[model samples]
Target: MGDVWAAGDAYEDYVGRWSRRVAVPFLRWLDVPAGKRWVDVGCGTGALTSAVLAWKDPAQVIGVDTSEGFLARARAQVSDTRASFRTGDARSLPLPDRRFDAVVSGLALNFVPEPHLAVAEFGRVAAKGGTVAAYVWDYGEGMAMMRYFWDAATALDPAAAELDEDRRFPLCRPEPLHQLWADTGLDEIAVEPIEVATVFADFDDYWRPFLGGQGPAPGYATSLDKEHRHALRDLLSTRLPTAPDGSIALTARAWAVRGVAGRPA
Candidate 1:
């Protein structure tokens, strides 16, 4: 089954919350100067765009995404005069070349059909000496919340492995991330891990969002019959570590890559 991207609110509940957290350290890592132009490619819900506006005090932040639902939510939430949302593809951006001082994407690179083309576009739009960066979940290991869920899920139904993001996206890893930037002729390449704490008051706080059907795991979840779904849920409940306060605390890690842009490969 294909992933869902049109339900902005549902996505917000799923990964947008964590993406916002990732955006903070991500911008700090870029260390771009104030009043620079920025492009948030695959800028879903304006999380990174809002971060640019709030943190970098940019001259402008142009956010591009394919989903109108996400752009609408972004437009509504990020009313800052410096930020604007547009519908566009990552592989073929409508932006002019070498116009942005900082080009960044958050939790979005892996979702691109051809992420290398998207990276090339990122390099194309970024000004000489400008920074190009993006982040994606470490779904195979470090993303604890999803890690636990997937572990519990695959155990219950081996077929679920086909939809598992860990197996699906190899580029989310650090080595591949660095190679992609290097192949694009981006210099000063670096890949760092950004982790955020995801604490759920109870299993329900974590479980209900899976029912929203906004992403791969959630989409896979809602596809199951009632019995199979409940079986998966029960399996997760038994497996996840629960604190005495009844909270389920987990960490989500995303691999972030950055480089200086100018040359093309």
Candidate 2:
């Protein structure tokens, strides 16, 4: 339940695309100035790192993650000279204190075990008055695609409801996110929702990602036996809102929060 990340390609195939969509607006919301030093904690596959390099024009952008597979992918995919990827724990980042002007994560905070520790690490490394921000899927209600998948999965197997992200990660909601930042002693704390269009070309586009076994829903899907997996998939097919043109358009919402890192107590 703590860390499901493996097979970076599979993870990219599943949610990396949507995470990139969220990253653009999330960066815009942060509005950090160009040439600032930035670090992306738990930077799974470098979604936010790439966004920072492209949009923010950071002086330097270091991406840290526990998953070597993801770090390798980040290095290969994000080819900017200003960016670098390293393997590091989110709860104990491998960096000097107060080195970065911006510390940001996207679609990753909820996946870190003891996420508060990771946020504390973010505060520990961010310069005073620097931006400390992150965004995560509102798995409870705002993330429609996963909501559809889990709702269908649980309808067929009521016991599977316990595996749902809405039940498992209480931190993905706005109140909890805001509180976590407050508890970290960050100033000017605020939270907002970021929604993006997740239009799947067809049912195959949506269903195949679940077979990737990267994130939670896909991990649960791949755990089932062949027949049971097929049953669960068929159930999802019927329940999803598919357009007559063989497309499925849904929205994903992530709660984004930001605060200015303050001096240590």
Candidate 3:
């Protein structure tokens, strides 16, 4: 929970495709204004933060996360002088009151232990009328790639039933998210589902990323003993479709929620 391995493009290879196609578009929908101060919570590797930095032209853009390893990578990837990366917790941010005009996160909200408090913190840090928007991957049936993986895994080994999609993809549906916004005191909250297409060339291209041990599913696979890992790999490869021309296409979905920080009641 506290650390993520940042050794290579292994994380980038698989996760990056999804980030570019799904996460980026959902984040951009917030339409951050020029010269505003923006904060990106859980700014893993600065992928979403850098995208915000580019799109918003903010007076300053701060990227905050818990991982020193992720911060190091973020520092390297983001070259903007107006941007800075720091180690911080979302539940208890270090910044002062009403410090930002906008706050946004991408695909990191679900992993937070107390998402409600995190949302409240977003409201607290955002100035009056400032916007807070976040994106999380839709789980199970909505996200085709991950759904396919779990489906294939369960068929191979019922013990894999422990790997249910609901646990990870909590915001896949809208009701809980809408209620969360109301509980957090966000005014005029709205939620939208967005899709991104992920493309892979051949079996090796898709399989290698799971071996990287970056995110949750990949981390689970990498933790398995060699025999189990091999068995899982064989099951997945056999189950997933392979294109005649050596390409695979999968769709991923994210629920993007946005709202304004209304005046205190």
Rank the models by TM-score, top first: 1, 2, 3
Poorest stretch of ten by lDDT in candidate 3: 1-10
Backbone collisions counted per model: 0, 0, 0
Question: For candidate 3, lDDT tens digit of each residue in 1-265?
Answer: 2224464356567576577566557656777668999888988778877777666678988888887877787898889998998888899887777879998887777777898989999999999889988877788566766676667667766766565556655655788888888899899889998987777787777788877877766776777789877888788777777788978777777788889987655
Per-model TM-score, in order, reads 0.98, 0.97, 0.92
Tens digits of per-residue lDDT for model 2, 64-152: 99889899888889999999888899899999999999999888888887999999999999999899999999999999989998998
Candidate 1 local lDDT, residue 225: 97
Please tell me which predicted candidate would have the highest lDDT against the true structure: 2
Question: What overall lDDT, based on C-alpha atoms, would model 2 receive against the true structure?
Answer: 0.91
lDDT of 1 by residue, 147-219 (tens): 8888888898888888889999999899999999999999999999998899889989889989999889999
Residue-level error in angstroms, candidate 2, position 156: 1.1
Clashing pairs in 2: none
CA lDDT of each prediction against the hidden true structure: 0.91, 0.91, 0.77
Per-residue lDDT, model 1, residue 93, is: 94
Model 3, runs deviating above 4 Å:
1-8
Of candidate 1, the 10-residue stretch with the lowest lDDT total is 256-265
For candidate 1, the lDDT comes to 0.91
